[model samples]
Target: MESFNEYHIDPKEFTFLKSFQDNWQAIRDEFIHFIKQASNEDLKLVYDILGPKSKTIKTKGDAKYSAFGILFQGMFIEKYIQVHQIKYPDYGAEEASQKALVLREKYFPSLAKLIEKVNFNDDEIIRNVYFGTFHPGLDIKLHVNYNPHTNRGYLGLIVPEGDVAMKICHEQLYWHEGKFLVLDHSYPHCPHNYTNYDRTVLVVDFFKPDKPREEVIQFENEQVTQRMQENPYSLGVFGKSDRAKVEDFIKYGFTHQLEWDKAL
Candidate 1:
């Protein structure tokens, strides 16, 4: 792997990369501290919590290119409906929402505690933790994740040995095991994996110290419920219009299960 200092990152193209580069050491140290405290067993606990729901959790992209994501949020979609007393006319929507809630509540508390330790600030509430996997040859096109109110942390767990890299604005970093990368996701970025193996990373999104966990959870659930109300398909799956795609989403939501491979 090449040294980050040897590479030139154009601030004009990657505004976030420039800021990150300037504070790379500090950020890296923070992540390293987190990793030292978190054992492999802790990671397994996270995997154990999310693994079964692998099928239902929505990943972005099409068959040609996709990145799987396991979302940990407060209030399962099912519970959300019951708590808010929402009555969905569509049976499919009702079932999906209920199922989503059940899965979320199953492991949310444990996952939240584990991730909270990583932030090193108990006051900073962890809003969501997404465990993502990118298959070989998957190229996530340039895009910006707009969340003005949160801080995002990326922990590289399983990275392929060859030519797989993530570009945050102007700078590029090759993936490696145990490497930590922090960024302001509101900036433009993309990922390219040229290797013949899968790459996995743990993404932690949290609110600032000012926001309490309960408030953050409430805000997030409201956003999720509103999205579902507007478009049932918007719940977890994205960009699908055809019947077959919809069926796949439904099937995955109900029975698509994934197990954590100890190797990863």
Candidate 2:
């Protein structure tokens, strides 16, 4: 492993960014084409891939001056935004991200394959972009506080070369290609730490297409930005209970046994 000062970012941070940047370009190009052509089918495909608008963050510092952690302050701001969404969804972009995180933690290796199957190849427009933000995918944020019970999922993929996953916990017990997860994310779950060199994955949240989008309020400048600070994971009583339940679900193993006739 490289020294923290050598790259300025810790190994985990460095790996996450490198993986994400590589993977997202491919998805972006495909999405850009869809945006330009505005084909009904392609537009639907884009919506399917990106979902609605994901969260966005304005950079607060210069990308050059900060060494290691210092030079790329804006990048960290975006990361914080992701964690904010994972922790707090009521005011965030989407509910899918946090839900997916919980699902991954609760169930082992269920959703990985479904996420991996996400490919933008069907769209002709995105093929040309070698690099750039051409994809219309929503920018959801994912936050994962360390948990001791289960294995944390790592993000990985073959194309566009960027990390689009939050805390992914790969499961060896139950996994099938394109059907690896038990639930779909409603928000963005950006990838964090891992051991692989080319660690990245295409993040796709599967949910009913009709899920309602939260209304967003935009501000013109920092005047509003200063007043607004991002908070991840709600701290309210209900929210705390929800988090605890997620932990409990992960701790207690799941089974298919159920009695349908009893309820009826």
Candidate 3:
């Protein structure tokens, strides 16, 4: 195999990312810290928890709202791929769903404890608020498109081998190091992979707030907005998003995630 030694990430960030791969508890702890410190108000917590960062990477398409979710360290994703017998072709969203399902089954009971540390109020929080995670392994790639208008992103990578490489791209974003280089999602980039190793990431979306009185009443009277959809890949097999009741939300839905849930 060609040694992509130039793709390695900095030791500090790599270490931090690694901590989450082996022990999600540590990741939860870090989130708790962000909650206690970064959040100044109740509503802000939702945004802060999901919002994008001001540093690390840059591309186009800045978001109207913030983007926040945890990206599994690459090494961890690799481990999940191995133990589960997950193949390179099975590294997309559906495969990730399977992994998470396994994870849910393996550690159902402990998730609540982890949630508690983050100060997530059981009553106020919706089940789907913390919705299921998204995992896209090497076969699944993310093409990040940034709006030329903003220089608000910094690209990062965390590879098992190679030195860290950083650059400014008006069009393309490549994964080179331990940091899964984050870029503005508004940009038009897509993930494409030809590698054998399965790469995975965690996608978390926070719950929408309770609507105000007038809007709630208006919404109650209105008909549901209908849109046509297609599921050619059978991705919906995971479960309905409506099933995301608050109690069900915290339960681990991805037992497959547990495949690599442990740090190797």
- Residues 1-264 of candidate 2 have per-residue lDDT tens digits of 323221122224222223333444443333334346555753443223222121232122221100001001011222323533433323343443443333323321222221222222211110001111222232322323211111122122222334322332221121111121222221112322221222223322111222222211121122124322321221100011112235433432221112233345
User: Residue 32's C-alpha lDDT in candidate 2?
Assistant: 36
Candidate 2 lDDT? 0.24
TM-score of 2: 0.22
Candidate 1 stretches greater than 4 Å from native: 1-124, 210-226, 229-264
List, residue by residue over 1-264, the lDDT tens digit for candidate 3. 322222222323222223223444444444445445542553353333222233212223421213333211111222323333433333554464455444333323243334333323332121111212112222222222222111111222112222222222222234432233433233323343333232222232112133353453243222111100122121111112212233332232232245446534
Native-referenced Cα lDDT, model 1: 0.46
Span of 10 residues, lowest total lDDT, candidate 2? 64-73
Show where candidate 3 strays beyond 4 Å: 1-105, 108-112, 119-186, 207-264
Flag the better candidate by TM-score, 1 or 3: 1
Query: How well is each residue in 1-264 modelled by candidate 1, as lDDT tens digits?
Result: 433321222223323223323443443444334335646764443333323222222324542232222343333334434444443433444564554444444434444334445444444344454546677777765454544445565557666688878765345666555545656655545667777886766565555344566666566666556544544433322212212334434443343233123224
Give all TM-scores, in the order shown: 0.50, 0.22, 0.28
Which ten contiguous residues of candidate 3 have the minimum total lDDT? 223-232
lDDT of the candidates, in the order given:
0.46, 0.24, 0.28
Ranking by lDDT: 1, 3, 2
